[model samples]
Target: MGLTAGVLAIDAGNSKTDVAVVAPDGTVLATARGEGFRPPAVGLDTAMAALAATVARALAAAGAPAVAHVSACLANADLPVEEQQLTEALETRGTTVEVRNDTFAVLRAGVTEPRGVAVVCGAGINCVGMHPDGRTARFPALGRISGDWGGGWALAEEALWYAARAQDGRGAPTALARALPAHFGLPDMPALIEALHLRRVPSSRRHELTPVLFATAADGDPVARAIVDRQADEVVTMATVALTRLGLLDERTPVLLGGSVLAAGHPRLVDRVRALLADRAPRAVPRIVTAAPVLGAALLGLDRLAAPPESHHRLRAHFGT
Candidate 1:
């Protein structure tokens, strides 16, 4: 029999790392998950070790003899320099590895068409695009600095800031004062502040507040509604930037919406963003992404193993199911 071909795919996010082994025919052979890989939080050694452990588990489960190709989609791998470092890191493991920003994998996961935009609002926000003419554009996505907002972390931070200001009589009072404490099992704002100061509540867990913010917004809390509205606007702005840069604003672009924030189905947030995009690019329509990013990473690995046109059908077929 001919040698069995296998690909290793990885999605390293702010809170967790997911790995999968895929057959050449696009079947997911096995999968594994581990802790987060954000360099600022986990350090390079721990991050790489986590990724390796997850991949090894996946390969073992799949009974794959060798990893013919690898693709890693990472949250902080935005800049080319960072991608280079990630590639070197993966190469050290003796695999033919391709590293790219997580947003790129998200876009690939959501779109089979030649040109489209993807926005992800998980721990942080990011947007990317690929045009039919082989052009691509991605936002800096460096959080507040890049004016990229709207994500679990951003919502949580905004909720806490608004709640604290309200407690100090500096901002409008909202349901968040009660909602945040109820959500976290804290008796009062002072207790919540103390817990945060003591690191009793880890940063990743702050994403828990995102739902509370959404709830308050739905309940007619003006401050919460304003925060959600602003976040929606920011997401739209990021998508617009990517579309304009890729010159795809005029096309029937598939705008993929991923991440927990958008997945919550907040009508205000989703409808407002849709309206904003419609105003600028009437062809833009939101596509709900159902495929996991790990699959996207695998598709990227498959892309490296075969020409784009050759793999397009297989990629779409695998994800479409």
Candidate 2:
């Protein structure tokens, strides 16, 4: 076995898993991608086995027998109990392991400093904030159960709901009445509903309609536009709350937006978010983070390792926007 000690970084979201081995000098040695993380549904043994497979592949590719640290940012780690369970589950793979909510990866990726707020709207939406003094603000982010409003899945479902209503005259007529059913190659809302109810259309694929919603909005559909606008409002609401909790609302705090939906840079969505922040938290600067979140996990590990600023800069340069 080769003797290269470095940080093992893992960013495990609901849809994908990214793992990387990075040297202390900021060199990324090896990287691997695998199926999304499975936990809370799948038992601990199954989850760890899947994760271990990816880690073994990365270490093998890097020719390293062991890493000094393991930093994993994972989805569904909402409650403190969940975090503790994940930490215990992941520690079996490395000498030192740390697990945090995946939104923390977004926060670390966008802000150069350790302090900032991040709202990640991917398959789901979550918000997190950190202060330099080590205090943090976060949400449960368990969908409607946790009072969360926006995410790709939720947005897509909302689009479908409105479109179905419009077709039946229960809601205002909109382009969605035609466009949404057509997206799935169906003739109309009734047909689409039948397909969904019969399980012919996979419910998991509903998130595909998120981009469709945006495209329809771009085409000047007021209903679709309203949905996009609501998403922006939700993003601001989460960010504003985080900043306020951390006492950074009036300060020059950096608000980072990450995840596929936000990072896609939808003009209507991004512009509205910017506009809302102007009134809600005027001093907050917004940034869309394009860097892969695994980099953030790696950076956090480097911080724990006490690597200097130069190392951080090097890693950033290697993964530059």
Candidate 3:
């Protein structure tokens, strides 16, 4: 296919979708964002259509007819069956289609090398690793039931739990007792608790409290600091297990961190992650991905086209850090 034919790249997360069109030489042709995919809730057809809307917009923006390939990194595509299902669905929209978990997007975005591990801490947490020999390691990442911990929602919930307990004298005193309710403009913990239980404040808004927890930790709130510490521990624990599983513990492995929680560069989190990784996996180098993961999807498209390193450079430069 010619460069003008281009490749369609899609990064579909639980909360949003980003689509891009890139030529064979890594020139970004078009980019668009749209609603998230909800395959489990709305079925595969609806989910694919949601993603296709963005793809169409990108194609229109670039004035391209049909892409030569499609590289998609999607959220909720945990199982092989799910990936295959999505791959089949996406192939209908393009000539050639590839689909993988969104964490792979983060992994590829941060590590230029083929071998590395990536942990994403957004609304939820997930870890995945790749070996140069084509081996891979990944967690199920189905949230609490899957033995996962330390994401924005988890952090906010931890803060609320501690604050509620502290209010009833079941836990140690902390600023969260006041800060958590105050964040919602409530008078006291009781009001905050009541509103949360009644859905007056809505549990979905719980994620909004994550920044409050981080800010309180920054001010030396012991309980909030403890949550941050646990988050750091979880990040390192996931990375350690992934690196060990892939047998990259002794190798100079790149440990890539992504998503809003880790990407925020909070000292309380990053500093502790650095310290823990130094002790546990001394050879692992931690790096926070500054680029959007859609770039990773685009790069995968270029890779499928067998574009060279210079093409990768041009894509990165066009996408920016």
Task: Give the alpha-carbon lDDT of every model.
Answer: 0.81, 0.90, 0.89
Cα TM-score of candidate 1: 0.90
TM-score against native, each model: 0.90, 0.96, 0.95
Sorted on TM-score, highest at the top, how do the candidates line up?
Answer: 2, 3, 1
Residue-level lDDT tens digits of model 2 in 173-233 = 8898788889999999999899889989988778888999999999999999999999999
- In terms of lDDT, the best-performing candidate is 2
Clashes of 1: 0
Q: In candidate 3, which residue ranges exceed 4 Å CA deviation?
A: 1-4
Q: TM-score winner among the candidates?
A: 2
- Candidate 2: the clashing residue pairs are none
TM-score of 3: 0.95
Number of the candidate with higher TM-score, 1 or 3: 3
